[model samples]
Target: MTTPAPQPIDRSGFGTTGKFNVSLSKRYNFDKIFSTAAWVATLFGLVVLAVLLVDILIDGLGRIDWAFLTSFSSRRAAAAGILAPLVGSIWLLVVTALVSFPLGVGAGIYLEEYAKDNWFTRLIEINIANLAAVPSIIYGLLGLQIFVRWLQPITNGRSVLAGALTLSLLILPIIIITTREALRAVPDSLRQAGFALGATRWQVIREHIFPIALPGILTGTILALSRAIGETAPLIVIGAVSYIAFLPELSPKGLQSSFTALPIQIFDWVSRPQTQFHTNAAAGIIILMVVLLIMNASAIYLRNKFQRNRP
Candidate 1:
């Protein structure tokens, strides 16, 4: 078994050095080129987005005012306002959050923490991932059949309640996925420590894991809601009217009232031939953008806050 040890390769042989044979200058040049290209692409995207925001501001700045915020849609473009859709959107958001949060977060915790790793769980995970990518219009049609037709008595036939349920279904996958990811982000040692202290699984999750992951969960929720708020096609399919003359009453009955949303109202205005309507549409678009941006900003702030506060 005693044999001669292998000899070291000759470093001075340039031809035998595969990758090492390449000139350092050539590698450096390639890296520089790729880096420059990346920067250019990034800047180009930023420039386009900035141009869009600036244009929207120019077109919509004058149209937004106290009256625009407080009044209702009218036949006259100048008199039309977003109050109905605004209030409806608020109602829809509240109801959607109420319905989706507990269900989604609970499912996530069950799947990630409690559920056994079996074929059934894997199948559910696969389905949940796929469902998150399903076209929203399909969910809308499903909602129309289930919420609008089947549950007409409860939803009052294409009311805010039905629309909220539809959107709740739409965003449930996102929330669940986000929540699981947030839970997964927590260290397993935290769970072990709780177990060492004689705490139950649920208690560990509720007291330790949830508190650590709260910011991420909340951020995901806000982003999901932002997406729901801006959705028009699903709302259209579920009969969210483009024009509603009156606001929903501030009662449980209001959940069953006919409604519209900001996106639907904007879509309606953009469709009209009148220039004033187009201008008003721009204004509505701005308000919707502001809402979405605010939500996104809040998510960023929460995420940063949690990272800063983490021990």
Candidate 2:
């Protein structure tokens, strides 16, 4: 059979010679518009952040010196320092880390590795997620009632320990959620292989799962602690004294000693009508931001190191 002759190509808008003609101006314009919008959105946030940072630095840079770092809060802004609040914040971080890390990680391990998927487990998970979203002030009230009033013998009502406990409660749900996600990321094959090699479940998790998940756990914990560091309302409700002039002793007694934090001190300074105090508040803000940045940098370094070393 002979093949039929090919038909002429349709080129209705062009000359007799077959040539394709197309216009992509509309699509090109749409892409350009979307790209510009995205760029603007990204820069908008960075611009605001830059402006605030510059303003704070300009207001406070001259105030930061050795005296500002060493002296305690005083009526005279020039003589005032962040010694008490800074020490209190450090103590609070230590206590909160000690209280929250083990509990949150253990709970996450049990839920992700041991617990059967039942209604009770589901209910607990749902409640935890909801609690994470609850306002920090609510946790403060809970801590005040339970840790301060109810367990006053130990917490000493409105002490550093009490504040730490409150902050721990506030960050517990976040730690738990982050831990469970990290645990879930571990492959089941690793567990099965360990079991086949005569290792028990506990051994498998202790040796295999924990090391792998540590980076993520650390990152989450640091971020939570950073959030806690900036919290004001919870500490205020739990009675973190705003006018503390002395550092708490670093001993058992210190846990019960009255304390203040950077945020509370900043709030106090900002509330005052004196311009000097406002400048002092800006200095405190700079310190707080530095602390947060350090923590975030640590998190990033740890995450990267672990990711590089992962099998």
Candidate 3:
């Protein structure tokens, strides 16, 4: 015969014979307090951001127009436009995406799936994590020494390509880490199932795992690209000009052309003593935000579409 069920004993708020015990009540209360605190913190952050955004809109909304977007920088604030830097920023985004996406994702896949855990791998992992936290200016200096000077022949010395490569280096570690995290979030059972079905490792990743992880991968890529787009120090260190009178042609040759980006342009404007330039800087900030928003929207759209395409 089955032994009598253990008596529900009150042992300091554990194993109680009630719908809810003291321990559960305490835990529930703790969770409620934590959630309330989190909600308050989130609301505070949103309020601050909203206030800043509203101020920027008021100061800069009138300044943004077709003429402002299409023209080049000029001494007259009314005539100034973001044409050069805008194009340069786009080019940098494209080039940096090209450079970093494959390398970062591939490295992450290899490290997570293929490389056996060892002292060497752990050291590499430690270095990558440390690198992600390094200051942007440090990357600028490194870029100055490597891409701008040592590889000047290949990078065409202070060109958009050089800036893009530098930005790629800046975000590569972040992307790799994010990719690995996304991959790791997949259940181990998926891999086991694939192997049980006689699939190769690569086949498992390609056919079953990668699709599930793709959305997360895209999110990480978006964050990395956003950081690259707003970067100024590296571009400045690599000699991105403040005034590019003309847009670089959209060709392979253009990759090596001198460039500027939104942050660089805004910095130049804000540095000037003229009040109008400061207003223009605000407008530039708005434009930069728009570009970033558009990029993110497109990526999100694509990610959603990819998900919908799946069975």
Candidate 4:
């Protein structure tokens, strides 16, 4: 007896007796809608940013000549410039980086490579993570109390050093966290191999792990510094003045001198009733943006270069 031939599959459901089945095309309409929505969301931020940039450029382009950069702040809007605030910002950044970078990187190395994994170490890690999320203003308040009031002789109240210290504290958690992450990204096999070769732990970390992690570490540091540069609340809390007609003296005494930053100056300008001051504020914003762009570009360049040079 011959077996009955198997019937052909009706994948198309086109036969008269075939039952209806779901079609894959049913989801296409939903996918199209979601794709369009995502595109709109992405463009929305870019559109807003473009509009802001165009407005600022239109208002401030003519105000950004050399004279604007060199002249001091003036009651007359036409004569007002960013020289004092600009210099103060530079000094603040220098101090902040000098203090924060070494301390942050050292703390990260200790926590990641040296610390015994225990309750105390875990607690410290948790606190650092929490600190990264703390408000900048709180750091400013801490600076005000510790650096300004408590250590008046050293920091001087409302001074560049005070502001720098404040900003440094503000960015320290970020730096530490990023550094740890960078170190952690290095493969464990490298460390093991270094040990297998009879190298010391410090030698392995310093010679092998750190070199491999340097690019990420530097990128994170630059990004953290960028954030510090833009911070206004912490500086304000640390008593940064809105007006300083003279340049900082660039000495220890200068570090203890009263100062203002670009953000503070812009805030002062925008707060004034005069329309020309508003225009000046726009010009200041343009300058601040340019500085930020340069910092970010440098970070990208350095990160890429180091990555390329890595074995």
Compared with the true structure, what per-residue lDDT tens digits does model 2 show for residues 113-170?
9999999999999999999999999999999999999999988888988999999999
Evaluate model 2: give its TM-score. 0.89
Candidate 1, superposed: residue stretches over 4 Å from native: 1-15, 23-28, 301-311
Ten contiguous residues with the weakest lDDT in model 4: 15-24
Tens-place lDDT digits, model 3, residues 27-111: 9999999999999999999999999999989988899999999999999998999999899899999999999999999999999
Q: Using Cα atoms with residue i matched to residue i, what is each candidate's TM-score against the true structure?
A: 0.91, 0.89, 0.88, 0.90
Which consecutive 10 residues in model 3 have the weakest lDDT in total? Answer: 11-20
lDDT by residue for model 4 (1-311), tens: 99999876776665422332334454677789999999999999899999999999999888889999999999999999999989988998889999999999999999999999999999999999999999989998999899999999888688888999999999999999999999999999999999999999999998999988988988999899999998999888878888677888968889988999999999999999998999999999999988888888988998899889886
Give one digit per residue, the lDDT tens place, for model 1 in 95-191.
9999999999999999999999999999999999999999999999999999999999999989999999999999999999999999999999999
RMSD of each candidate relative to the true structure: 4.1, 4.8, 4.6, 4.0
Clashing pairs in 3: none
Off by over 4 Å in 4: 1-35
- Worst 10-residue lDDT window, candidate 1: 12-21
